[model samples]
Target chain A: MDYTFQFGVIAKHLPYLIGGAWLSLLLAFLAFWAGAVIGLLGAMGKTFGGRVLYRVIDVYVVFFTNTPALVQIYVIFYGLPDLGIVLSPFNSVLLGLTLNCGAYLTEIQRAGFQSVRREELEAAETLGMSLWQTVRYVIAPHIAKTLYAPLSNFYIWIVLGSSMAGIFAVEELTGRAINVSSSTFRTIEVFTYTAGIYVVLTVVASALLALIGRHAFRVKARIF
Target chain B: MIERIVDEIPRFFTWYNTIFFLQAMGVTLALTLIGCGLGSIFGFALVYGRQTRGRLFTPVRVLIVGYVEIFRRIPFLVLLFIVLFTTEGFGVRVSFFGIALIAICVISTAYISEIIRAGFEAIHRNQWDAAEAMNFGRVATLRYVIMPQAWKVILPPAFAYFVMFIKDTALASQMGVLELTRVAKIFNDRGYSAFLTFGTCLLLYFILSYPLTRFGQRLERRLASSRNR
Candidate 1:
């Protein structure tokens, strides 16, 4: 119980850690957008495609969602080399996260698709709305309203989840913290600071997301 | 490379290795169950604390809220490191498994408390008023009225969180806990093909989680339908 605090050593490495924080955000942003594209397609296929297509996407979603992203990345980063396919740690973590995020987002976006009632679509059609107009004025808004909060929450989940990249040597915020703690031998202080950074990073991300959701989608996302 | 993996398969599934993997899976499950089980209890306590009224309870509510908001935002990996190092710094001789359990419990309590709070909030305010009119204390009201209704709403998401933790406990491997991922790392480091080792690790996790997920979905649907009725 006699451990003295040592913020002084970690102070010099603040910029390095900040750079790592930026990498964490960049990683989450990239994976989220990439996953969104995959999820959109998967949701569409599951909702409207043939049974075979539905089954394929279902399997992908099930497999990815059920497995840990860390192990999935482990398989990709370590196991893939056995099959003559090697990826950089960053690429492997990104690929793992994208696939995992896609599975969850597929489920989320699919729920959004289901939330659109048939009556609403029929009403738009009865109003003489074209396909694009119906999609724009009726369907898009409906989906956006239903999906915005969960999507933002998942984005923040990805931000937190991206800490897994540190284990794979990605040099993100957690990775840099590992480096500093190992080098400085200030394990507790280093991790405490890293956790603080993560808390601040996610709080800011949540607030920004809440603001965007409020204005853009009219969804009352909670900031805290 | 393919041939190498093929060659390693027979060796990988030996009786000893099979037992090793099964034991590792047990550790993973134990971590999830113990962690989330404790989490649910502490989470309910947190919800109760936060729901208390009066100026005296304001700090308690704020502290509970701050714990939830801050802990939920921190990544599990960082939390693990913090727990690991903090325990070390305090010179407590905790096992790696104990460290992992502490981290999981801390995070799950934060998350499950939010879920429990939302579940309680799902009950109508009039229900609380009715309980108050009957002279029921907060504990009595929660026990007799709110929990009966709220558990239906809480069970599905809480169960989903449990399943999520099954996969997440894989990170415990990073801190040298001999969980499934650690087993895979051990086998792979022992000259086994990574494809065979980690692939089996992935499949084992899928086996563990997929059924619980299906059950949670079914529970959600059933509860939703019954609630509507």
Candidate 2:
């Protein structure tokens, strides 16, 4: 319990920590965007595609949702080399996170899509819209309206979950903090500073998302 | 090179290693159970505090919100490292188990409180009015009427949270606690078989959590059917 609170050591590592934070943010942003694409496709597949596609998406969601993301990262980072397809630490972690985020996003977006009333879809169809157009002009916008808050939360989740990437020596904020802690033995200071950075990053991310939602997805005034 | 490594798996599972693994599982489970128990108690307090809006309501609200934000915002590994080692600053010694339990409770309480609040919100105002019309005392109404229903509604979410709590306990390993994952990490470091070690840890977590997942699903289904009726 004899721990030193050495701010100097941590101060020296602040640049590294910030760099790590940037990389972590990059990882989350890439995963979020990639996952959104995967999500849109998977949602469509699950909701409207043939039975085989639906079942495949169902299993994908189940497997990813049921397992811990940490375990998935470990498996991807460590197990892939055995099969002769080795990945860099960064790619392995990114691949694990993107796939995992994609699964959860698929479920969330599917729920949003399902919530789009049948009447609205029919209205779009009656206007001579093609299947793709109907989905684009009708279902996608409707789902986006209902999904902003949950999507924001999911973004925060991936940000937080990215902390696990440090385990694979991806050198994110937590990893940098650990290195500082080991060298300086200032465990408390190192982690506290890192956690503060995390809090700031997430709060900023959430604010940005909220503003985007307000500007991009605002609809006509609600009677309620 | 790979053959030499693959050939040593059987020898790694010595009697001592197997015993340590089982003991580590026990530690992990114990920490999870203790955390969940404390979390439930604090969680209920939070939900009630939020609902009642009594004299303590504003402070309680602020406290709960702050608690939830701080824990949820912070990474689990950071919290684990701090709590596991920071006690001497207060001139008191705390064991690793104590720190792990406290960290889990602190984190889980926020989630459990939200789940409990959701349960409370799910109860219709009409149901509350009906209970009041029956001349039930506040205690009796909560115990016999509101609670049973809320408890049922919260079970699926609470059970899911419990599984999360179990999995999170693995992070205690970073603090040098002899938990399942830590033991696996040790074995992996020594054996240089990261695949086997992490793979085993993954399997252990699945073995522990999958049953809870099934139970939660069943409870959710039952709740859905009853609600429909």
TM-score for each candidate, following the candidate numbering: 0.98, 0.84
Docking class of 1: high
Residues A133-183 of candidate 2: C-alpha lDDT, one tens digit per residue? 987889778888888777887888789878877777788887777777788
Best by lDDT: 1
Point to the candidate with the largest DockQ: 1
Q: Give the alpha carbon lDDT tens digit for every residue of B1-229 in model 1.
A: 8888788888889999999999999999999999999999999999989988899999999999999999999999999999999998989999999999999999999999999999999999999999999999999999899999999999999999999999999999999999999999999889897778998999999999999999999999999989532
DockQ of each: 0.87, 0.40
- Candidate 2 chain A: worst-modelled 10 consecutive residues by lDDT: A215-224
Query: Comparing chain B with the reference, what is the TM-score for each candidate?
Result: 0.98, 0.89
Maximum-TM-score candidate: 1
What's the C-alpha lDDT at position B138 in model 1? 93
Q: List runs of model 1 lying over 4 Å from the truth.
A: B227-229
Instruction: Look at candidate 1 and tell me the lDDT of residue A83.
Output: 70
- Report the C-alpha displacement of residue A204, candidate 1, in angstroms: 0.9
Stretch of 10 with least lDDT, candidate 1 chain B: B220-229
Lowest summed lDDT window (length 10), candidate 2 chain B: B84-93
